[model samples]
Target: MIPLDRFSGHANLYAQYRIDYPPDLYNYLLSFVTERRAAWDCATGNGQVADVLANSFDQVDATDISETQLILAAKKPNIRYQLSQAEQTPFANQTFDLITVAQALHWFTIDAFHQEVRRVAKPGAILAEWGYGLVKLGSDLDAVLLDFYRNRVGPYWDPQRVHIDTSYANLPFPFADVQHNQFTIHRNWTLDRFLNYLRTWSAVRQYIHENEEDPVTDFGEQLKAHWGEGEREIRFPVFFRLGRVMDEPVQ
Candidate 1:
Protein backbone atom coordinates (compact mmCIF):
# COMPACT_ATOMS: atom_id res chain seq x y z
CA MET A 1 0.00 0.00 0.00
CA ILE A 2 1.27 3.47 -0.79
CA PRO A 3 1.89 5.49 2.35
CA LEU A 4 -0.54 8.21 3.34
CA ASP A 5 2.30 10.73 3.19
CA ARG A 6 2.43 10.26 -0.57
CA PHE A 7 -1.22 11.36 -0.74
CA SER A 8 -0.66 14.68 1.01
CA GLY A 9 0.51 16.45 -2.12
CA HIS A 10 -2.48 15.42 -4.19
CA ALA A 11 -5.13 15.62 -1.47
CA ASN A 12 -6.91 18.62 -2.95
CA LEU A 13 -6.99 17.22 -6.47
CA TYR A 14 -8.11 13.87 -5.12
CA ALA A 15 -11.04 15.48 -3.36
CA GLN A 16 -12.01 17.19 -6.59
CA TYR A 17 -11.39 14.56 -9.31
CA ARG A 18 -12.08 11.29 -7.51
CA ILE A 19 -15.52 9.99 -8.43
CA ASP A 20 -18.13 9.84 -5.73
CA TYR A 21 -20.21 6.77 -4.86
CA PRO A 22 -23.65 6.70 -6.38
CA PRO A 23 -26.56 7.83 -4.19
CA ASP A 24 -28.18 4.41 -4.62
CA LEU A 25 -25.16 2.76 -3.04
CA TYR A 26 -25.63 4.82 0.12
CA ASN A 27 -29.40 4.15 0.17
CA TYR A 28 -28.72 0.42 -0.05
CA LEU A 29 -26.22 0.58 2.79
CA LEU A 30 -28.59 2.65 4.94
CA SER A 31 -31.39 0.09 4.46
CA PHE A 32 -29.54 -2.25 6.80
CA VAL A 33 -29.05 0.28 9.57
CA THR A 34 -31.83 1.63 11.74
CA GLU A 35 -32.61 5.33 11.98
CA ARG A 36 -30.21 7.40 14.10
CA ARG A 37 -27.57 4.67 14.14
CA ALA A 38 -23.97 5.38 15.18
CA ALA A 39 -21.56 4.81 12.29
CA TRP A 40 -17.80 4.89 11.84
CA ASP A 41 -16.15 5.71 8.54
CA CYS A 42 -12.67 4.25 8.42
CA ALA A 43 -10.05 5.54 6.02
CA THR A 44 -12.53 8.29 5.31
CA GLY A 45 -10.53 10.39 2.83
CA ASN A 46 -11.77 13.96 2.72
CA GLY A 47 -14.86 12.65 4.60
CA GLN A 48 -16.76 11.95 1.39
CA VAL A 49 -18.12 8.63 2.68
CA ALA A 50 -18.59 10.12 6.10
CA ASP A 51 -20.61 12.95 4.56
CA VAL A 52 -22.88 10.39 2.98
CA LEU A 53 -23.05 8.34 6.18
CA ALA A 54 -24.02 11.46 8.12
CA ASN A 55 -27.19 11.86 6.08
CA SER A 56 -28.45 8.58 7.57
CA PHE A 57 -26.75 8.11 10.92
CA ASP A 58 -27.20 10.33 13.95
CA GLN A 59 -23.48 10.21 14.76
CA VAL A 60 -20.68 9.68 12.28
CA ASP A 61 -17.05 9.37 13.34
CA ALA A 62 -14.44 9.41 10.57
CA THR A 63 -10.72 8.62 10.92
CA ASP A 64 -7.71 8.58 8.62
CA ILE A 65 -3.94 8.29 8.94
CA SER A 66 -3.40 11.42 6.86
CA GLU A 67 -3.81 14.52 8.94
CA THR A 68 -3.60 16.57 5.77
CA GLN A 69 -6.60 14.75 4.35
CA LEU A 70 -8.43 15.06 7.66
CA ILE A 71 -7.76 18.79 7.72
CA LEU A 72 -9.46 19.18 4.39
CA ALA A 73 -12.38 17.07 5.71
CA ALA A 74 -12.89 18.99 8.93
CA LYS A 75 -15.53 21.25 7.42
CA LYS A 76 -18.33 18.82 8.11
CA PRO A 77 -20.13 19.51 11.35
CA ASN A 78 -21.58 16.02 11.71
CA ILE A 79 -18.28 14.20 11.28
CA ARG A 80 -15.61 13.92 13.95
CA TYR A 81 -12.22 13.65 12.26
CA GLN A 82 -9.32 11.90 13.97
CA LEU A 83 -5.75 11.33 12.88
CA SER A 84 -5.82 7.55 13.31
CA GLN A 85 -4.94 4.55 11.21
CA ALA A 86 -7.45 1.86 10.21
CA GLU A 87 -5.49 -0.90 12.03
CA GLN A 88 -5.94 0.89 15.36
CA THR A 89 -9.18 2.86 15.59
CA PRO A 90 -9.51 4.88 18.80
CA PHE A 91 -12.99 3.81 19.69
CA ALA A 92 -14.58 1.60 22.32
CA ASN A 93 -15.57 -2.03 21.82
CA GLN A 94 -18.96 -2.86 20.36
CA THR A 95 -19.86 0.79 20.06
CA PHE A 96 -20.74 1.47 16.46
CA ASP A 97 -23.85 0.36 14.61
CA LEU A 98 -22.05 0.38 11.27
CA ILE A 99 -18.47 0.62 10.00
CA THR A 100 -17.67 1.71 6.46
CA VAL A 101 -14.47 1.72 4.44
CA ALA A 102 -14.64 3.21 0.96
CA GLN A 103 -11.92 3.31 -1.70
CA ALA A 104 -9.24 3.39 0.99
CA LEU A 105 -9.75 -0.21 2.22
CA HIS A 106 -7.42 -1.55 -0.47
CA TRP A 107 -4.56 0.20 1.34
CA PHE A 108 -5.16 -1.42 4.72
CA THR A 109 -3.73 -4.58 6.29
CA ILE A 110 -6.84 -6.74 6.14
CA ASP A 111 -6.20 -8.83 9.24
CA ALA A 112 -5.52 -5.91 11.53
CA PHE A 113 -8.23 -3.71 10.01
CA HIS A 114 -10.84 -6.45 10.39
CA GLN A 115 -9.87 -7.07 13.99
CA GLU A 116 -10.20 -3.40 14.83
CA VAL A 117 -13.53 -3.19 13.02
CA ARG A 118 -14.86 -6.24 14.85
CA ARG A 119 -13.73 -4.88 18.17
CA VAL A 120 -15.40 -1.52 17.63
CA ALA A 121 -18.59 -2.60 15.89
CA LYS A 122 -21.69 -3.56 17.81
CA PRO A 123 -23.39 -6.93 17.54
CA GLY A 124 -25.38 -7.21 14.33
CA ALA A 125 -23.56 -4.24 12.87
CA ILE A 126 -22.93 -4.11 9.13
CA LEU A 127 -19.49 -3.66 7.58
CA ALA A 128 -19.71 -2.03 4.17
CA GLU A 129 -16.41 -2.14 2.28
CA TRP A 130 -16.65 -0.77 -1.22
CA GLY A 131 -14.57 0.52 -4.16
CA TYR A 132 -15.04 1.57 -7.77
CA GLY A 133 -13.23 0.44 -10.90
CA LEU A 134 -11.69 2.96 -13.30
CA VAL A 135 -14.11 4.97 -15.38
CA LYS A 136 -14.70 3.60 -18.87
CA LEU A 137 -15.01 5.94 -21.80
CA GLY A 138 -16.39 4.21 -24.91
CA SER A 139 -14.41 6.22 -27.44
CA ASP A 140 -10.98 5.32 -28.78
CA LEU A 141 -9.70 8.35 -26.92
CA ASP A 142 -10.83 6.62 -23.74
CA ALA A 143 -8.88 3.55 -24.79
CA VAL A 144 -5.69 5.58 -24.77
CA LEU A 145 -6.40 6.66 -21.18
CA LEU A 146 -7.15 3.08 -20.17
CA ASP A 147 -3.94 1.88 -21.77
CA PHE A 148 -1.96 4.38 -19.75
CA TYR A 149 -3.49 3.08 -16.55
CA ARG A 150 -3.14 -0.60 -17.43
CA ASN A 151 0.45 -0.47 -18.66
CA ARG A 152 1.95 2.34 -16.62
CA VAL A 153 -0.21 2.85 -13.53
CA GLY A 154 -1.20 -0.75 -12.78
CA PRO A 155 2.37 -2.12 -12.73
CA TYR A 156 2.97 -0.59 -9.30
CA TRP A 157 -0.11 -2.34 -7.89
CA ASP A 158 0.82 -5.43 -5.89
CA PRO A 159 -0.70 -8.57 -7.45
CA GLN A 160 -0.35 -10.51 -4.20
CA ARG A 161 -2.50 -7.98 -2.32
CA VAL A 162 -5.89 -9.51 -1.57
CA HIS A 163 -7.63 -6.22 -0.72
CA ILE A 164 -8.61 -5.23 -4.28
CA ASP A 165 -11.26 -7.94 -4.53
CA THR A 166 -14.67 -6.28 -4.16
CA SER A 167 -16.18 -9.49 -2.77
CA TYR A 168 -16.78 -9.78 0.96
CA ALA A 169 -16.17 -13.54 0.98
CA ASN A 170 -13.11 -14.84 2.88
CA LEU A 171 -12.74 -11.54 4.72
CA PRO A 172 -11.55 -11.66 8.33
CA PHE A 173 -14.68 -9.92 9.58
CA PRO A 174 -17.02 -12.04 11.71
CA PHE A 175 -19.81 -11.83 9.19
CA ALA A 176 -22.37 -13.91 7.37
CA ASP A 177 -24.35 -13.84 4.15
CA VAL A 178 -22.15 -11.37 2.32
CA GLN A 179 -23.61 -9.68 -0.74
CA HIS A 180 -22.44 -7.47 -3.61
CA ASN A 181 -23.94 -4.84 -5.90
CA GLN A 182 -22.91 -2.89 -9.01
CA PHE A 183 -24.21 0.44 -10.23
CA THR A 184 -23.29 3.19 -12.68
CA ILE A 185 -23.00 6.96 -12.23
CA HIS A 186 -22.68 9.64 -14.85
CA ARG A 187 -20.71 12.84 -14.43
CA ASN A 188 -20.24 15.81 -16.74
CA TRP A 189 -16.65 17.02 -16.70
CA THR A 190 -14.78 19.67 -18.64
CA LEU A 191 -11.47 18.78 -20.24
CA ASP A 192 -9.57 20.48 -17.46
CA ARG A 193 -11.51 18.57 -14.81
CA PHE A 194 -10.79 15.31 -16.60
CA LEU A 195 -7.07 16.03 -16.88
CA ASN A 196 -6.92 17.17 -13.27
CA TYR A 197 -8.47 13.87 -12.28
CA LEU A 198 -5.81 11.97 -14.19
CA ARG A 199 -3.06 13.96 -12.54
CA THR A 200 -4.28 12.91 -9.09
CA TRP A 201 -3.22 9.31 -9.69
CA SER A 202 0.01 8.59 -7.82
CA ALA A 203 1.35 6.09 -10.31
CA VAL A 204 0.64 8.43 -13.21
CA ARG A 205 2.35 11.27 -11.41
CA GLN A 206 5.34 9.08 -10.53
CA TYR A 207 5.70 7.77 -14.08
CA ILE A 208 5.70 11.28 -15.49
CA HIS A 209 8.17 12.62 -12.95
CA GLU A 210 10.62 9.70 -13.36
CA ASN A 211 10.62 9.77 -17.16
CA GLU A 212 10.41 13.57 -17.58
CA GLU A 213 7.16 13.07 -19.41
CA ASP A 214 4.94 16.00 -18.44
CA PRO A 215 1.60 14.29 -17.86
CA VAL A 216 -0.33 17.51 -18.31
CA THR A 217 1.40 18.50 -21.54
CA ASP A 218 1.58 15.06 -23.20
CA PHE A 219 -1.59 13.38 -21.96
CA GLY A 220 -3.61 16.54 -22.44
CA GLU A 221 -2.53 16.69 -26.05
CA GLN A 222 -3.40 13.04 -26.59
CA LEU A 223 -6.87 13.49 -25.09
CA LYS A 224 -7.59 16.67 -27.02
CA ALA A 225 -6.45 15.07 -30.27
CA HIS A 226 -8.73 12.09 -29.71
CA TRP A 227 -11.82 13.68 -28.18
CA GLY A 228 -11.55 17.16 -29.71
CA GLU A 229 -12.13 18.56 -26.27
CA GLY A 230 -15.18 20.18 -24.69
CA GLU A 231 -17.48 19.50 -21.77
CA ARG A 232 -18.66 15.86 -21.62
CA GLU A 233 -20.18 13.51 -19.14
CA ILE A 234 -18.96 9.95 -18.65
CA ARG A 235 -20.67 7.00 -17.04
CA PHE A 236 -18.74 4.51 -14.95
CA PRO A 237 -19.55 1.40 -12.94
CA VAL A 238 -19.21 1.42 -9.15
CA PHE A 239 -19.22 -1.67 -6.93
CA PHE A 240 -20.31 -2.25 -3.35
CA ARG A 241 -19.96 -5.24 -0.97
CA LEU A 242 -21.97 -5.42 2.23
CA GLY A 243 -21.83 -8.05 5.00
CA ARG A 244 -23.60 -8.42 8.31
CA VAL A 245 -21.46 -8.98 11.39
CA MET A 246 -22.86 -11.91 13.31
CA ASP A 247 -24.67 -11.26 16.60
CA GLU A 248 -22.97 -14.22 18.20
CA PRO A 249 -19.50 -14.10 19.81
CA VAL A 250 -16.48 -14.65 17.60
CA GLN A 251 -15.33 -18.27 17.83
Candidate 2:
Protein backbone atom coordinates (compact mmCIF):
# COMPACT_ATOMS: atom_id res chain seq x y z
CA MET A 1 0.00 0.00 0.00
CA ILE A 2 1.12 3.55 -0.65
CA PRO A 3 2.33 5.20 2.54
CA LEU A 4 -0.73 6.66 4.25
CA ASP A 5 1.43 9.17 6.04
CA ARG A 6 2.79 10.79 2.90
CA PHE A 7 0.59 13.86 3.28
CA SER A 8 1.00 14.15 7.04
CA GLY A 9 3.94 16.53 6.98
CA HIS A 10 2.17 18.95 4.65
CA ALA A 11 -1.36 18.50 5.91
CA ASN A 12 -1.64 22.19 6.66
CA LEU A 13 -0.64 23.06 3.10
CA TYR A 14 -3.37 20.77 1.81
CA ALA A 15 -5.98 22.51 3.96
CA GLN A 16 -4.82 25.90 2.74
CA TYR A 17 -4.04 25.31 -0.94
CA ARG A 18 -6.11 22.41 -2.24
CA ILE A 19 -8.87 23.34 -4.68
CA ASP A 20 -12.44 22.68 -3.68
CA TYR A 21 -15.16 21.15 -5.81
CA PRO A 22 -17.60 23.58 -7.39
CA PRO A 23 -20.94 24.21 -5.67
CA ASP A 24 -22.90 22.91 -8.63
CA LEU A 25 -20.94 19.68 -8.49
CA TYR A 26 -22.02 19.24 -4.89
CA ASN A 27 -25.61 19.99 -5.88
CA TYR A 28 -25.40 17.37 -8.62
CA LEU A 29 -24.09 14.69 -6.25
CA LEU A 30 -26.72 15.42 -3.62
CA SER A 31 -29.57 15.65 -6.12
CA PHE A 32 -29.18 11.98 -7.06
CA VAL A 33 -29.57 10.70 -3.54
CA THR A 34 -33.08 10.40 -2.14
CA GLU A 35 -31.99 10.02 1.45
CA ARG A 36 -29.74 12.66 2.92
CA ARG A 37 -29.36 10.77 6.17
CA ALA A 38 -25.68 9.85 6.02
CA ALA A 39 -22.63 10.10 3.74
CA TRP A 40 -19.03 8.93 3.77
CA ASP A 41 -16.07 10.86 2.40
CA CYS A 42 -13.25 8.37 2.16
CA ALA A 43 -9.67 9.57 2.13
CA THR A 44 -11.13 12.80 3.37
CA GLY A 45 -7.92 14.77 3.46
CA ASN A 46 -8.60 17.99 5.33
CA GLY A 47 -12.29 17.05 5.11
CA GLN A 48 -12.99 19.46 2.28
CA VAL A 49 -15.75 17.38 0.70
CA ALA A 50 -17.02 16.18 4.06
CA ASP A 51 -17.64 19.75 5.16
CA VAL A 52 -19.95 20.24 2.21
CA LEU A 53 -21.72 16.96 2.83
CA ALA A 54 -22.28 17.98 6.42
CA ASN A 55 -24.39 20.89 5.27
CA SER A 56 -26.76 18.57 3.44
CA PHE A 57 -26.66 15.29 5.29
CA ASP A 58 -27.76 14.52 8.81
CA GLN A 59 -24.32 13.10 9.48
CA VAL A 60 -21.03 12.98 7.60
CA ASP A 61 -18.44 10.36 8.46
CA ALA A 62 -15.02 11.30 7.16
CA THR A 63 -11.94 9.05 7.28
CA ASP A 64 -8.25 9.27 6.43
CA ILE A 65 -5.21 7.22 7.30
CA SER A 66 -3.13 10.27 8.10
CA GLU A 67 -3.63 11.47 11.67
CA THR A 68 -2.29 14.89 10.83
CA GLN A 69 -4.73 15.25 7.97
CA LEU A 70 -7.57 14.23 10.24
CA ILE A 71 -6.33 16.66 12.87
CA LEU A 72 -6.64 19.44 10.34
CA ALA A 73 -10.13 18.42 9.24
CA ALA A 74 -13.00 20.85 9.26
CA LYS A 75 -14.91 20.86 12.48
CA LYS A 76 -18.70 20.78 12.30
CA PRO A 77 -21.32 19.34 14.57
CA ASN A 78 -22.50 16.75 12.05
CA ILE A 79 -19.14 15.79 10.61
CA ARG A 80 -17.36 12.96 12.43
CA TYR A 81 -13.69 12.64 11.51
CA GLN A 82 -11.71 9.44 12.05
CA LEU A 83 -8.42 7.82 11.17
CA SER A 84 -9.14 4.86 8.90
CA GLN A 85 -8.16 3.38 5.57
CA ALA A 86 -10.42 3.46 2.54
CA GLU A 87 -10.44 -0.31 2.01
CA GLN A 88 -11.57 -0.90 5.56
CA THR A 89 -13.80 1.50 7.49
CA PRO A 90 -15.58 1.42 10.87
CA PHE A 91 -19.00 2.13 9.39
CA ALA A 92 -21.94 -0.17 9.92
CA ASN A 93 -23.40 -2.30 7.11
CA GLN A 94 -25.99 -0.65 4.86
CA THR A 95 -25.42 2.65 6.65
CA PHE A 96 -24.74 5.40 4.21
CA ASP A 97 -26.93 7.01 1.56
CA LEU A 98 -23.90 8.25 -0.38
CA ILE A 99 -20.15 7.61 -0.51
CA THR A 100 -17.61 9.89 -2.13
CA VAL A 101 -13.91 9.78 -2.91
CA ALA A 102 -12.66 13.06 -4.29
CA GLN A 103 -9.28 13.35 -5.98
CA ALA A 104 -8.33 10.24 -4.00
CA LEU A 105 -9.79 7.09 -5.49
CA HIS A 106 -6.71 6.36 -7.56
CA TRP A 107 -4.55 5.82 -4.47
CA PHE A 108 -6.67 2.97 -3.20
CA THR A 109 -6.43 -0.77 -3.72
CA ILE A 110 -9.67 -0.33 -5.60
CA ASP A 111 -10.91 -3.91 -5.71
CA ALA A 112 -10.73 -4.14 -1.94
CA PHE A 113 -12.15 -0.67 -1.48
CA HIS A 114 -15.11 -1.60 -3.67
CA GLN A 115 -15.93 -4.49 -1.40
CA GLU A 116 -15.98 -2.24 1.65
CA VAL A 117 -18.19 0.23 -0.19
CA ARG A 118 -20.61 -2.60 -0.89
CA ARG A 119 -20.60 -3.55 2.74
CA VAL A 120 -21.46 -0.07 4.04
CA ALA A 121 -23.65 1.48 1.35
CA LYS A 122 -27.40 1.24 1.55
CA PRO A 123 -29.40 -0.33 -1.30
CA GLY A 124 -29.23 1.79 -4.46
CA ALA A 125 -26.76 4.14 -2.81
CA ILE A 126 -24.59 6.30 -5.05
CA LEU A 127 -20.85 5.70 -5.18
CA ALA A 128 -19.14 8.69 -6.71
CA GLU A 129 -15.43 9.09 -7.45
CA TRP A 130 -13.71 11.98 -9.16
CA GLY A 131 -10.29 13.49 -9.81
CA TYR A 132 -8.85 16.64 -11.38
CA GLY A 133 -6.14 16.69 -14.02
CA LEU A 134 -3.22 18.96 -14.89
CA VAL A 135 -3.60 22.65 -14.08
CA LYS A 136 -4.44 24.99 -16.95
CA LEU A 137 -3.11 28.52 -16.66
CA GLY A 138 -3.03 29.90 -20.21
CA SER A 139 -1.30 29.30 -23.49
CA ASP A 140 2.13 30.58 -22.56
CA LEU A 141 1.99 29.84 -18.87
CA ASP A 142 0.60 26.36 -19.46
CA ALA A 143 3.50 25.59 -21.75
CA VAL A 144 5.95 26.52 -19.02
CA LEU A 145 4.13 24.65 -16.30
CA LEU A 146 3.67 21.58 -18.49
CA ASP A 147 7.40 21.38 -19.04
CA PHE A 148 8.04 21.64 -15.31
CA TYR A 149 5.42 18.96 -14.66
CA ARG A 150 6.42 16.43 -17.31
CA ASN A 151 10.16 16.99 -17.46
CA ARG A 152 11.16 18.08 -13.96
CA VAL A 153 8.86 16.41 -11.44
CA GLY A 154 7.11 13.77 -13.54
CA PRO A 155 9.40 10.88 -12.66
CA TYR A 156 8.58 11.26 -8.98
CA TRP A 157 4.89 10.49 -9.51
CA ASP A 158 3.51 7.12 -8.50
CA PRO A 159 2.43 4.80 -11.30
CA GLN A 160 -1.19 5.08 -10.19
CA ARG A 161 -1.01 8.77 -11.02
CA VAL A 162 -1.79 7.71 -14.58
CA HIS A 163 -5.39 7.12 -13.50
CA ILE A 164 -5.81 10.82 -12.77
CA ASP A 165 -4.09 11.87 -16.01
CA THR A 166 -6.60 9.74 -17.94
CA SER A 167 -9.45 11.31 -15.95
CA TYR A 168 -10.22 7.96 -14.34
CA ALA A 169 -11.51 6.61 -17.68
CA ASN A 170 -9.00 3.75 -17.46
CA LEU A 171 -10.03 2.72 -13.95
CA PRO A 172 -11.80 -0.61 -13.61
CA PHE A 173 -15.10 0.78 -12.32
CA PRO A 174 -17.40 -2.10 -11.47
CA PHE A 175 -20.67 -0.23 -11.21
CA ALA A 176 -23.46 -1.15 -13.59
CA ASP A 177 -24.66 1.66 -15.88
CA VAL A 178 -22.06 4.16 -14.77
CA GLN A 179 -22.64 7.88 -15.32
CA HIS A 180 -20.34 10.88 -15.55
CA ASN A 181 -19.98 14.66 -15.64
CA GLN A 182 -17.24 17.19 -16.34
CA PHE A 183 -16.50 20.16 -14.12
CA THR A 184 -13.73 22.60 -13.41
CA ILE A 185 -12.18 23.61 -10.09
CA HIS A 186 -10.57 27.01 -10.42
CA ARG A 187 -8.79 29.43 -8.12
CA ASN A 188 -7.62 33.00 -8.57
CA TRP A 189 -4.11 32.83 -7.18
CA THR A 190 -1.10 35.06 -6.85
CA LEU A 191 2.21 33.53 -7.91
CA ASP A 192 3.08 32.77 -4.30
CA ARG A 193 -0.23 31.07 -3.67
CA PHE A 194 0.09 29.07 -6.86
CA LEU A 195 3.58 27.87 -6.05
CA ASN A 196 2.48 26.96 -2.55
CA TYR A 197 -0.25 24.83 -4.09
CA LEU A 198 2.31 23.03 -6.25
CA ARG A 199 4.27 22.22 -3.11
CA THR A 200 1.32 20.08 -1.99
CA TRP A 201 1.59 17.72 -4.96
CA SER A 202 2.50 14.16 -3.91
CA ALA A 203 5.01 13.93 -6.75
CA VAL A 204 6.65 17.20 -5.77
CA ARG A 205 6.84 16.07 -2.15
CA GLN A 206 8.36 12.72 -3.18
CA TYR A 207 10.86 14.51 -5.37
CA ILE A 208 11.97 16.75 -2.51
CA HIS A 209 12.34 13.75 -0.17
CA GLU A 210 14.28 11.44 -2.50
CA ASN A 211 16.52 14.28 -3.59
CA GLU A 212 17.64 16.77 -0.95
CA GLU A 213 16.36 19.82 -2.81
CA ASP A 214 12.98 21.40 -3.50
CA PRO A 215 12.42 21.71 -7.26
CA VAL A 216 9.51 24.09 -6.78
CA THR A 217 11.88 26.74 -5.48
CA ASP A 218 13.77 26.84 -8.81
CA PHE A 219 10.62 26.35 -10.92
CA GLY A 220 8.81 29.14 -9.07
CA GLU A 221 11.43 31.62 -10.23
CA GLN A 222 10.96 30.50 -13.85
CA LEU A 223 7.16 30.66 -13.51
CA LYS A 224 7.28 34.11 -11.95
CA ALA A 225 9.02 35.41 -15.04
CA HIS A 226 6.10 34.20 -17.11
CA TRP A 227 3.46 35.06 -14.48
CA GLY A 228 4.47 38.73 -14.28
CA GLU A 229 2.12 40.14 -11.64
CA GLY A 230 -1.49 39.97 -10.36
CA GLU A 231 -3.70 36.96 -9.77
CA ARG A 232 -4.18 34.37 -12.48
CA GLU A 233 -7.13 32.07 -12.73
CA ILE A 234 -5.87 28.51 -12.48
CA ARG A 235 -8.24 25.82 -13.73
CA PHE A 236 -8.22 22.11 -13.03
CA PRO A 237 -10.64 20.09 -15.13
CA VAL A 238 -12.54 17.60 -13.00
CA PHE A 239 -13.66 14.14 -14.13
CA PHE A 240 -16.47 12.43 -12.20
CA ARG A 241 -18.26 9.09 -12.32
CA LEU A 242 -21.16 7.74 -10.29
CA GLY A 243 -23.16 4.52 -10.25
CA ARG A 244 -25.70 2.83 -8.07
CA VAL A 245 -24.52 0.47 -5.35
CA MET A 246 -26.70 -2.58 -5.69
CA ASP A 247 -26.95 -6.17 -4.50
CA GLU A 248 -24.07 -7.39 -6.56
CA PRO A 249 -20.96 -9.27 -5.52
CA VAL A 250 -17.75 -7.27 -5.79
CA GLN A 251 -15.34 -8.90 -8.23
lDDT of each: 0.74, 0.90
Top candidate, metric lDDT: 2
Candidate 1 lDDT for residue 220: 77
The residue pairs in collision within model 1 are none
- Give all TM-scores, in the order shown: 0.88, 0.96
Q: Which lDDT value does model 2 have at 126?
A: 92
Off by over 4 Å in 2: 1-3, 249-251
Q: After TM-score superposition, what is the CA distance of residue 225 in candidate 2 from its true location, in Å?
A: 2.4
Best by TM-score: 2
Q: Which residue pairs show collisions in model 2?
A: none
Model 1 TM-score relative to the real fold: 0.88
